[model samples]
Target: MVQSGLSQPEKVIGSSYNHAKFKLLTPSENSTKTPEICHAETIIVGGGVIGCAIAFELASRGQEVLLVEQSEIASGASCAAAGMLAAESEDFAHPFMAKAAHESRELLHKHKEQISAITGMDIGLRRSGFITPFRSYSDLSKYKDRRNTTSGVQQLWWDRSTVQREALWLNRDTYGAYYRSLESEVLPVSLTRAYARSAEMMGARILEGVQNVRLVVDNHGVRGIKTAKGEVCCKHIIIAAGLQGEQLMHQVGVALPSSPVKGEIMAVRFPIDQAGGRPDRTVYAEDVYIVPKANGEVWIGATSLPGRKDHSVSANSVQRLLGAASYWIPGIKEADFVRAWAGIRPSTPDGLPYIGKYEQIPGLYTAYGHFRNGILLSAITGRWIADLLEGKRAEEIGIEALSPERLNRKGVML
Candidate 1:
């Protein structure tokens, strides 16, 4: 519950009249003839969490929705995430983002049961909470001040002795830890697939393995989308394309400032009977996080390389992550190394995600650049997009701060 600050001034550049003057065709548009036209009320791009969530919400509201994906749903960053729903643990620069994250985390609680019931898939939703270990008194004091300023978050400070008693595998050098009881974790891939399955059940068409996808726009607004197979005639299109969003938006004459931030993570298996048993909750130490799954497997991650895009795991990153994990939980060093992988997350200059209709391009909306919090923010972003398309007032959803126009004013290049 961080205190609110003055709302940033809206930086919309020009009126709708100025935007209507430019009519640009996408690269695919020039070569394609009038492709077979399929129709839907709304077409959503990128079948990841955000897109699938929005499709599910829209379909639940009885909107005919079409979701197009270049690859399988959740095959990108959505599946590679550690799935920590740490709203309270995340550092928010704005009060609005904090509130939105809290609300989204709460939404997960409400939807978890429903999603499992509908999809018949256990999403591995766990309320294991999160603990942040500190190395020294000065480090603890610095975080204490930050946490103290946050109004309604429930946090508990643990002494070194208490921390040792609670998590026996922790290093003796650990000074203390802060525990946030409301934090939770989930299996990101399962949760994302659940959303896609539920959306399909609710009558949303999800087209995976699509190729040569591009937007078709006119003076009025978005007319449809062109794909390798055909064209989808739709009035509204939402882009939640993750790392590929920048290129997609650029094709339609929109400048989205986003880049691929690569993260490498590993999975390790531990025996249940091992000495200093596996941690029952998520543990955070500096840049390292260890998430324990119910299946005797633990996830150790991650190294954020901002400009890197290759999914190949480097030995150096793996060594660093594993070394840090072992320092936090001594028993982790003994665990069987399962696998290592990487994903490219979409990152923005400012940390906040872009979530709103483009003022310059009517009927074109975006929900991308969520970075690490994509899984945590999926539910709320879906609801927000649904609300906007349904003509809900901007103030009702408090989405003004996340408007795409902010990037426009910042002179973000394609």
Candidate 2:
């Protein structure tokens, strides 16, 4: 098993956007487990970004892995996501999540070349930064202090004139704006498909169309998983089933306090000339952001709501998104709408994601509750869990603050 190192990454300076340098990784060779109705080193229940990532990491580390998904890959929130690697875009008070997200972005960069080589796909990795406007001087003051540092991020303050010159369609009503060159966006479907394909390339047995029923338990730990198709014996089991993780955890009485936070996003396509040759940066104003892909397609999103689980696209929601987008960037008002959809983000009470093994159950690890950061957090989450399985230090990933036991301690489990 080859270990991934955190090589020093180059920082994007001034205004130029350079393609990121990513390491190339080859799949490790291991003995094939003879299919005698038997074992896998790790059995992942979901095939979304998290599950596929875990499978890729485990298999690349010479573990026999099996991934079970009820449908085609990226059919859930992964499919509906408007991928934004924006840690700093989130509130600054949440340092735990901010650190995790920032690290995850770096990990994604580290694995980019390997991921592309393994999947033989682009994955749509881009370096388009984020633009957000401040409504008042108070907002600018608070953000100015935060954006002063240039160590981990490159944020440029923009006045009205600067915003107008840089952002082609920005509304004139903004007080000021801030731009960070580190925030990025990706095509969700491309990333998800590439990750799953990469896992397969790493010798993982991806069994799509099959779902895990329950954990095969013993006094020591989880021995395997019982599936509708058959039983898969495995030394370890990782439950990365987003939105469905709590239900499956409850089957074994390991209650998890997690629920679906529904979000709606609309994708629209405009003529290249209309979009100013695809304005090189992503736009984030209010609760929505517009991401322009390598192709001419643009993705605008997303509205977040708590206690909402519906995936159906609402006409009113689309209208509201369009109206708000029009208010910010008037050119979008005339753009043709291509698609609209919804996704259920798996959110816990606190913003931190759950990682590492369960307290009462050994060999049973839980990796869900990533909320909107799944796409960004996938690679590191995979590497972290792989390290845990290989008897490495848990502090190596600095994820001790995000533990499943926190749900139990806070009396929030179930």
Candidate 3:
């Protein structure tokens, strides 16, 4: 289901290489001899944050889970994400989304300590908060209701003077800033690897570099999946393959209307003692965001170009992002340029993720179209999907609004 225009696979050397460091499967590896057919309770397609998290949850709950990935884990959007857990900052047009995001953020915070302790990986989970600067009061008025409805979130409206005092590098035109103290950030690649490692430790079979994957369906329901390596016969199949999920579902006569939204981001480094030393929190202004890592590297992103599939970093996007960054933090102009990269994020018409069982096919489930929130919602999506498969009610888990049926009922063409 992981489709790419690049035909050849990248070469990977080691067996236990981290997803962030590993390359794709080589040509010879893709033609390896098929092994014997395997069986599992559930087969999850895709190895991004969502899939890895789901695998971790299901395996931890004692379910026999097999995760198949066409490429290395977290090699997609998960690795490119800025890792902002912005439940409060996100648009909550649908009340249920707000609830789900809130719950997901809580779960992320709750498990941050435990996961880091177990894996000994610094996930860089920080509750350093997020700030959205406003150029005018009219701009602030537009999101007043949304900001107020962020219940249980610590919200503060800082005056221009306070903003200048806290973030001295901001532009003079900045009027004020709305701060959400509970919003957090994490190292997405580290988190995904941690989840995958933890799931494997708990008996989940994760197969990477698997090519030519196809779903095995029967008159009753989805039987399992077949890959270049071998076949996996399972009771259930989950499609969390991000942008490629639509194509996979279409193979089974289901129309999943989703598109790839391309985003470009850049990382800039600064000396520890420099005036541009990493900011204390994530800052958003004029559709650009600056996320600081503990290592004095600031991630300034991102340009969201909808309906774009190419992951090529454009000069225009990079110039625009850097200009915005310089406008927000004057010192950013002097920071050392690190690298710029791009990713294609999956999105739906309504900007809501599809996270439930498909009615047309039994034992077939989906957890894709998360758009920009995949990393933020990964923990709760996994937990809820595992819960649903384990016989928990949708209403009980409060994810009824995220059902796939909503898209079908709307009659949106795939």
Candidate 4:
């Protein structure tokens, strides 16, 4: 089945804001197996940003692909992402990660253009950059040397006056800021759907509402998958299944060292004639980072709670987010409160995502544990995975540092 990309995403202001009402297709107790058999060169299990990215890249390279999502695409963390491609602003734990994020941002740009040309959809991509306002000069001075360069990402310092001028609504305590134009953003679900639709346009098959998947791995390598529908034969399978896919890996023999990190976000939008208006650049203040969308909506997010799977939004989280946001950008306090929601991000033992072949199981690969960087890392994650599966060098993507085998050496894998 094929669906075209979105022409224009729905505005989140006017309507009563509701999160994506997608129900994940889970393993049914009475799910019966059928005799129907499917075939593909690579089978992707998951429909999040990473899975769609991989599917698009593989299909683009003339591979027969099958993507099976438990529910509608972008039903999980992908839809809830703030979509910040903060390669430099994030200050990754490792040098290799910084490099990966920088490359992935470029890949995202290339894919964004390709998808737009193919589907005539605007993914709400903003290259406006990031505004990291510091309330104290001491805090601002901490990154005085960051202006030099790291992983080829450069930075420009904006003095207090420059920052306040850029964002009139910003509080007076804002000492200075760092302007990183390379840091970009997008509407998360829009990009995910675009990738999936683009893959479909390239003759890749997508099966939504597919669940209860079992790997068909033999002694030699990956054979395919057995779903509730029937058998799907494939040479390789990628478990980009987010938090839920860890179970499948454990059952396959090796354990993926991953856990859930929950985050809550609130949206506050202004009328067309609002006084100061939404900040053009994303506001990455010390307390709360605010991401302003193309529309009049401003997203104040993300209270990180590790090892948390509960997606219920808490009043305390909302209060903290609002309080911090108002402290940084006072004008936002007057904006109309749209809605609040929660999502669970898959985080690994280390900071980086696990994206490489599991040597113990031939042709079996898994890519997850991106934590808050899923949107930023999705592009390269997909491309590198496809290249590796095509017999390309893993060193090109820094699999040595991001390999799943690291968990075994670290004694963290369960």
Candidate 5:
């Protein structure tokens, strides 16, 4: 439910503090009389997968959680994701990041059924293997010898004949592929909705369609937040607002370097009944990835353009994506074009999401800059947030590595 925004500026009752002023547009009657002063143990901003998952995790731990969003949940990068729960395919700068992804995917495996049961929404979580076709033999030759010793991700070598038997449609010039059983697929929107709905079932409150969001800070730390939908008083605040979340963090002077990366993806109608059938599993080629959806449309994507904020899909980008996919799976040339869209992913300079507390500001934390792994990491990110808030930490997840202050030492903080 969306709360009404304020019509004018309202003063917050607190001592001298640093707060940004964004005009609220709520019912003036309510503001002139008494602003809606609700209370919660924690107030989470941004209703994407990360925000919703954090709400669910906190509620599951018996914490009163309130989430506020400027738009509908999952309308950002969360919904735009291709929904590949990938760990091995991603070339991580840190081994712990990969390990964290593996653990997060496991969390999804453990909680998907329970969330679906509570929300009555099929989250579409499946154990679909992922294949990364290698263009040259030297690349396949290396992975053939050993697995990822650091992250413990299993690997296998699939010869060209094996590829044909498994995915007959992929009649390409590629020599072989590196296969990993850990990568899975899910419906991004469905998974995000399931998390949000389950959180509501557990008594968590969600406010959508809010605007002009700004935090109320004091000497102690975050006091509460003012929005177009009145005000909320809380002890803790976690910003998971995706791309737009950077603005809030910047205003707070937390100095976490965050940027945007745009990814354009499309779906095409595949004729499954044709002579050469489609692959049962997802395929990641050199230039593109093909994901089979429940609606018989093979979702092929995407073109990653960093330092971009807009979601406009360029005709040249579409042509490049389609051409690359067709080179691998010739059926794509004949497949009917469906639709295409774009999403701006939140990214950081070092490529690691900021997950821990900012010691400079107590009761302030962040789960932003997750980039493309937001969907895959949402579950574990929530668990980590809960752990951090309760004066706890998970060593295996590398809490310090994801700290918001890690990059500040390099003097990159804004």
Candidate 6:
């Protein structure tokens, strides 16, 4: 048998490259000899929120984990997401997503202090609540009855007077509005980076620029990954590669039913008091959201453009979001736009994430298909994947709703 794993010498020879756009720290020059084989308890492909979260959980539980990313952490949809944690704002018709979304929020709230302590960064976790204003009385009346999941959940109904009192910058000509206290917001990139930092501190190896080409499954199960460089043998493999899940699945003869749904967003800097109010909450209005961050920057976005795979920001998308946002805020038309970016969300046909193992592949599991909820759901995704890796039942969330087996029944082409 060939001796595998990084030799002692190779560890010393890698060099670090630092540039504004990107950075790479190569294996040391005295890097240990590249072993003919590599081994770990788990190998996570992708460095986005899903993979990083799984890596963090596995490493925390004393499992040797390897997280390979084709690009920098938070470079995928995780980076482009607006970080809204409102299961209510999303389609409530899907009970499974609703439950998972709520549970994920609970998990994020529970782990806030620990995450801050470990990452030395505030996750920009704001429980400031969310307000959805309406210019149409018909729309206002639709939600005026105040319907939600639980009786304990409070939905604040705001008439014109209340909106004015709260400094909700609606033109006096506006109608009424509603506020959901359960909804909150965070800076997605910041939160994701914190997870990556914590995972690295816990002894997880995060290798950027390392693309996983395929999984190497032996007679028993997944042995490791076949990367551009070489094979990495691992006992368990997690496919958290976002929209790339189907391609990876093809390599192993399993059909992962997934597709890419693209969206674009723009970032802007604005003074806190520009809205003529003391800000304490996020504003979700007119199919757009205005999230105030602690750092004096606000993220307003996210126009859903279905079927666009390229990550280029289009003029129409920028104009449309800006127009819609300005219609809600009125003042945003005067604000200076800072930056714009796009990402392709991994979407399932039914809009729910796939978060369990393929029944055919013993050691292979999946945690992708998050779509727009990827950022908000990352915290719990790690724990859920960890449960599967440990052969324990998922407590906070039910996996049967999102089981890989369920997607197979949909008859999607491989």
Each candidate's lDDT (Cα)?
Answer: 0.79, 0.73, 0.79, 0.78, 0.77, 0.71
RMSD of each: 10.1, 9.3, 5.2, 6.2, 8.1, 8.1
Q: How accurate is candidate 2 locally (lDDT)?
A: 0.73
How well is each residue in 1-414 modelled by candidate 2, as lDDT tens digits?
A: 111111101111112111121111112323333333357777888888898888878888888887778776777778777777776676533565667678878777767788766655776678778898876788777765765343455578898888878876777777778898788776666666677777777777776666546777878888877666666677888888888888878877778867788888776777756766344678876557777775556777788888888776677777788887777777787777777777889988776677887857888888998888898888888988998889875666667777778778767554
Give the clash count for model 1. 0
- Rate residue 38 of model 5 by lDDT: 64
Which window of ten consecutive residues has the lowest lDDT sum in model 1?
A: 1-10
Tell me how far the alpha carbon of residue 378 in candidate 5 is from the true structure, in angstroms, after superposition.
Answer: 0.7
Candidate 5 lDDT (Cα, whole model)?
0.77
Q: Which window of ten consecutive residues has the lowest lDDT sum in model 6?
A: 4-13
Instruction: Please give each candidate's TM-score.
Output: 0.88, 0.86, 0.88, 0.88, 0.87, 0.86
> What is candidate 3's CA lDDT for residue 394?
76
State the weakest 10-residue window (summed lDDT) of model 4.
1-10
Candidate number with the higher TM-score (2 or 5): 5
lDDT of 3 at 400: 80
TM-score of candidate 2 relative to the true fold: 0.86
lDDT of 4 at 254: 76
The runs of at least 3 residues in candidate 3 whose Cα sits more than 4 Å from the true structure, single-residue gaps closed, are 1-37, 142-153, 273-277, 410-414
**So what's the TM-score on candidate 6?**
0.86
Error of 5 at 128 (Å): 1.4
- lDDT: which is higher, 2 or 5? 5
Candidate 6 local lDDT, 320-372, one digit each (tens): 88787777666776666767777778888777787887767788888888988
Which window of ten consecutive residues has the lowest lDDT sum in model 3?
A: 5-14
Model 5 spans > 4 angstroms off: 1-37, 138-151, 393-397, 412-414
Return the TM-score for candidate 5, rounded to 2 decimals: 0.87
